[model samples]
Target: MEHVTDTPTVKAPAERFTGDVFLHPIATPAEPARLAAALVRFTPGARTHWHSHALGQVLHITDGVGLVGTRDGNVVRVRAGETVKCPAGEEHWHGATDATLMAHLAMVVGDGSGDGTSWLEPVTDEQYAAALAGPGR
Candidate 1:
């Protein structure tokens, strides 16, 4: 067995997200692994843009409530202790609810080298508003 030593603890930045909203990245791709994990804290009414993974991704909710939506109009509400999986190449976006601060562990497989993830444009406000309008209205 190989003994690992001296692993340093890294802290999440105050502002590590993109776009006009606030979402912190606890960990990133530079952490020395093919698998990347991040503790994303989303502000109310904030979310990620439409994107896809080359080898799929997983989200483990840690606190509050979150919303995950697909391009096909499938919106999933994930709560603490729940997990959501996005299949490879499936376009999707995730974020906090309109009234809650959501926190989740985002696990992305496959590094930037081969068959990486593709991040598309941000989710439009119209799409978000429609999602909040609830199902089959």
Candidate 2:
């Protein structure tokens, strides 16, 4: 087995995310491979735009607190050691809580197009506010 030594840490683009986010790719689909994985870090208030994957996605939280929400307005709080899954074509968004920095390992299956996700609009302020205001605080 070859050690992966060339993968680089990348800042999440502002066009796809809010606040500060970074990621280190752990694996990428190459030819025969069909899976991609990354370690993603998010600063407080940082989050991804609403998006969906062609073959589903999984987020395994490794640190701090985070929130994951769907188009239906259900926001779930996830903490370290927790994991969340989004079914294929299910629109969703995920990020650190407003006061917490969070990190997670993300895994996705590729659909042969070299791209697995279709990103939509940023999470509106009202949506976020409503999430934070939901029961359980």
Candidate 3:
């Protein structure tokens, strides 16, 4: 095994995120590996846009509390040490709660594509508000 250097943190793209979000890329293996991982941090109320992975994604909460929602109006609260799995091609969004910062290790399994996520529109404020109002799982 080879040693890896510390990676830089970058601001998440505004087009794909709401509020303040940052990403510290952890792993991006060569082509045949088809995997990518990152430590994603979200400020209170920050969230990702609607997106789906070609294969699927797994998230392990690292700090604070987070919300993961789907297009079907389901929102689940995930805390530190908790893990979430999103099936292939399931449209979803996730981020910090209204008053808590959240961080998670996001591991994405791709479908041989360098970029396997199909990023969709931003989740509307109404959608987010409704999610927060609903009960968490």
Alpha-carbon deviation at 10 in model 3, angstroms: 0.6
Q: For model 3, how does the per-residue alpha-carbon lDDT over 1-137 read when each residue is reduced to its tens digit?
A: 86889789999999999999999998884677877999999999999999999888999999999899999888999999999999999999999999999999999976675648899999999998988888862
lDDT of 2 by residue, 20-50 (tens): 9998999888878888999999999899999
Q: Model 2 RMSD to the real structure?
A: 1.0
Candidate 1 lDDT by residue in tens digits, 1-137: 43645445443332333333433444456434567666677778878878899889999999988789999999988889999999999999988888888888888866568336787887888888878776632
How far residue 79's Cα lies from its native spot in candidate 1, in Å, is: 0.7
Candidate achieving higher TM-score, 1 or 3: 3
Give me the displacement of residue 55 in model 2, in angstroms. 0.9
Regions more than 4 Å wrong, model 1? 1-32, 111-115
Tell me the number of clashing residue pairs for each predicted model.
0, 0, 0
For candidate 3, what is the lDDT? 0.92
After superposition, the stretches of candidate 3 with alpha carbons farther than 4 Å from their true spots are: none
Q: Give per-model TM-scores.
A: 0.76, 0.96, 0.95
Best by lDDT: 3
The residue pairs in collision within model 2 are none
Cand. 2 Cα-lDDT: 0.91
